[model samples]
Target: MTAGPRRRGPARTVLVALPLAVFATVGVLAPILAPADPTANDLAASLLPPSAEHLLGTDQLGRDQLSRIIHGARISLAVTAAVLAISVTVGVVAGTTAGYAGGFVDRIVSRVIDMAVSLPGMLVALAVIGVRGPGVENLVIAMSLWAWAPYARIARARVTGLRASPHLDALRLLGAGPVRIICRHLLPPALAPCLVYASTDVGAIVLGVATLSFLGLGIPPPQAEWGQMLVEGRPHLASAWWLAYPPGLAITAVVFASNLLGERLAVGDERPSILRWVLPGRLRVRGGRALAARVTGVPATIATTSAGDGTLLRVRNLSVAYPRGSEHRRVVADVSYDVPRGKILAIVGESGSGKTTSALASFGLLDPSAVVTGSAMWEAGAAARQLVGLTPRERRQINGRRVGVVFQDSLAALNPLRSVGAHVDEAVRNAGNPGQRTAIRRVSEDLLHLAGLPDPATVTRQFPHQLSGGMRQRVQIAIAIAGEPELLVADEPTSALDVTVQARLLDLLARLRDELGMAMIIVSHDLAVVTRLADNVAVMYAGRIVESGPLDAVIGNPDHPYTRGLLDAVPRPGTVPGTRFRTMPGRTGAGPDDTTGCAFAPRCPDVVPECAHQQPRLLALTSLPAHRSACPRQQSDGPALAAETARDPDGV
Candidate 1:
């Protein structure tokens, strides 16, 4: 059954690809294929008419028209190939250099291209030929000089547009040099259009060479070139018309065929002929069917292997790093945690502290540039799966079905074009419950109602813009729970909402957690929100979890100086009017070149000399074994640490 499409692919490719192959072969083997010497002339047979003895008859010089036409293919094709090579090479290098370098270099190159493009191609060719004198070599050189400008403009525009791609920025963050980035990332996408342009240019180049030859400037006379043949036949046109028509017709056919092939390449129709069928994997039609079958089939069930003590997900020694010159900067360093079923574990940190990075790593959603080292064991229903090294396809099978995520911005997460119901319907389909149309609709409404929307039916019919901020967030939660995933990772779910809305949304999440019995990972910088929702809290600083324990213990009895600072910075209700709000003493940022010692040492209020010299390891408190702090001076009493506050030098 699959062989039908596979068989047809080669036939379509051959139909489009055959003419170019035949033309190139005949041109390359002109000497062997020609019936007679193309340059030889016999006065006795001058202008002989078409007959069985001499096909295409004789030119004005009595040379065989068929042989001259065949040999002309060699010259035209050779010059066209040379022009393509020289023009494309020079244009690509100059254009990519200018676009990637930008600023001064871009301005200079753009002006040069403008000036070059302003000059007429024919006039520039004429001036070059005038200086160097006319010949096949000079003609090629002159054509290349003008031909490269167009390709340069095309390549420059393409590179300029792609300079800001996120993939390229990620490469830069990974320590890739400018040369490597331009060559590997910028050049490939720019090459497609340049190649298409080169294809179409072949016909123009052939026409130029012939025009020069007809004007008595190219290939001299007895070469039996098509253009020279045309010139020779013009004077004898009144008496013998066959002499002019054959060469003209041959030139027309070759140019038209080249153009036809160029158009096919531009439109992406020239597929790999026999290779399409021989290599079954490359066939899209076959691959699509196979993918559809796999998606629809019963999902592979996993055996639930406990990480220990009923933990739903266990992450051990999780670290994420990006390259910096010769070394790597760890963003999340040796972080470990566990979330039991129906429990909320909040990862709290300021921006760039690696809270989100660590959360994403557990789900195998980190970028390719990040080097993640650790194990994220997810216990799903009856089976346990390791998420760190799963292939993308394998990860896809579990992501929406076993683990769902509600991103920070509801507006960005919900497609503006799609209705609220459409988003939920997609999640329902992804959960492998793609039932009949009516059933899918009912399931979508049920999921929305479960997410706490008052009118699930009305909300389902509205677009993302038609809903309020809280409603959009509710829709997002509805989509997240549509799959009934065992674990839900909410990254700053209520950060964008007003205080009233934020409180309502938090309550909705708590209700959902209880009703669904799903493990939840709440990622937030807001400690108040974390206090209200999280059963356990992990405080992060400079990519490492500086302190972690039960919520009341970590917040009421803070241990690490950084954690203490964060708690002090939060605003409380009893503060007098006109008083300045507390702020952390130092700014926050992280990079691969972090010092060997503690990352938060510079910002620590009670920093000691040893804090800058030795990196602290997260160790369990002797008093509370489950509670851990990375500080060497681990105070036994949380109330004592919380009582002490450092006075800021710059008071507002």
Candidate 2:
């Protein structure tokens, strides 16, 4: 179940802020509040307990207990702050570099981090201070040396995970520099938990300084510190317990507050799922109709699937082949399609149908081992260009700006560390927008709202992990559509959603297409989904399209046997619940070379002698000039035609 909205009120904020404020102030103002000189020699007034004049009573130093406690504050606060700073900075940098660079650098860094962690913090600090001679600087050096290793190790682990995240991949595809991507995407999440650690560590580091000082190995006593005071008060502990107790309590208070605040802050902000916020807002309604209009400029023919006719994107004879183990085979073969301005075209196929591969081919984002050959041309307004044969820089200039994609998995698509608003801002920035930071953030909030997220301002402040699956998907849509590109490629955009959520997402996409006038390519395994949003549908089987035409004509009377089989697969409620489902016979085989005959023949019940021996070209199936099919016997054989003509008699 989705989490309910977080209550926002002064009580919660105060509960979080009060302790932190108190601790911070005490730590920072310690030096000014000592009732007596912490370092003043008081050999005469030594060993006195609670008294009216002495208040908490005099210590072994004849000095006021309160004064000594206050003085100790300065030393502890400095040590803690210094250690935290050194550790966080060193850890984030080292880990980020190691994670992002990977390979040899990562191995070497990991080894170094492991080696460092083998030593305990106290031991390391003691060794460093022992050699350096105990002083403020030496003590700081000791604690920092001990502190940074753990931070580095954890940060390294987090970075390693982030390096492989899809958001990073998406950023790379958009031409983000290594530093920009790492700092923007990788570091934020890595550092948030670290922030909590760092906050808590301050108190511990301060205590370490006090410990060394107490042991005569920390800050030499001309400078008043809690440990020094404790050491000085040791001789009179029985009588002057006030001296030691006050300072001890002060340290406890600061540490406790910091710890509590750290834990609370660590919970982070709440972020709802983007799919909820974005998809429904953009597409859905109570009436279950696509009330939104198609995008301007797209041809009406394609708009029926989503609207506009500007030839926003075109792909010609695209092919992509991935290696099996070490052997080579083409996974996607000779695919072609066009995305008109402000229109929706759905690519329908089962798993391994090459729908995704085909999309990947258009952008030259195939795996290194997968050889890709294709020319994709795209135009928006006056911006006409060819995607194939373009250099990295050239592709960078166009990808996020001219073409945007909503991946199947929104969580995979978004950076877990970043807030929804930031991701949207990134898309806008990548598109070459000149807005200021404030404007960018505002636009992000607005986009989140448009995507259907509530409490836009608060939601904008949340990281991806805070959101639900649906909300995350909505944010992904927001980011993808943020740039307002001419072409939007949705690869199984709603595949992971439940029926209601899926319907809502479909409605949102249809609305956005009409409102923004953007052309869309919806890739899915379900033809029903295509029928909902596609003006034109292309049925793919074994990496090739077997049929193509208007959605209504194609669904009403599928010419290809494979296409008919797909339509029959959509489940219908209230049907005989336990009835066995009809399924296509054989799995999609390997590529063109894997089989000499039609790839579907093994599964095609009407397979003939000629089907196994000859390859068939996509041919016009009827007088409907736009309708086409790849089956060789489309013009002949009543048996196969009868099966193709058959519908779900049960209305399922």
Per-residue CA lDDT of model 2 for 127-173, tens digit only, reads: 88778899878887888886887788778888887787787776665
In terms of lDDT, the best-performing candidate is: 1
RMSD of 2: 8.9
The list of candidate 1 runs beyond 4 A from truth reads 1-22, 258-537, 541-546, 549-623, 629-652
Q: Each model's TM-score?
A: 0.53, 0.74
User: All models: lDDT?
Assistant: 0.75, 0.71
Error of 2 at 238 (Å): 8.9
- Which lDDT tens digits does candidate 1 get at residues 1-652? 9878766654654565465566678889999988999988897898899888788898766888888888888877888899888998888778887888899999999998898889998788888888999888898899999899888888899989867655455445434578877775566556667777776787788888888888877767677677887898889899888888877876776677668766766655442322223322211211111111121221122112122338888888888988879978777877889898778999999988889998988766666668888888886557887888777678777778778888776776665544687678777776767466556767777777767788888998788889988888888887887666778899898887899999999998887666557778999999988889999999988888888888988998887888888888788898898888767777775442465677776777777777766767666655565667878455333443333312211100
Point out where model 2 deviates above 4 Å. Answer: 1-72, 92-120, 153-186, 230-249, 255-307, 325-327, 365-368, 389-393, 415-422, 425-442, 452-472, 568-583, 605-609, 620-622, 634-652
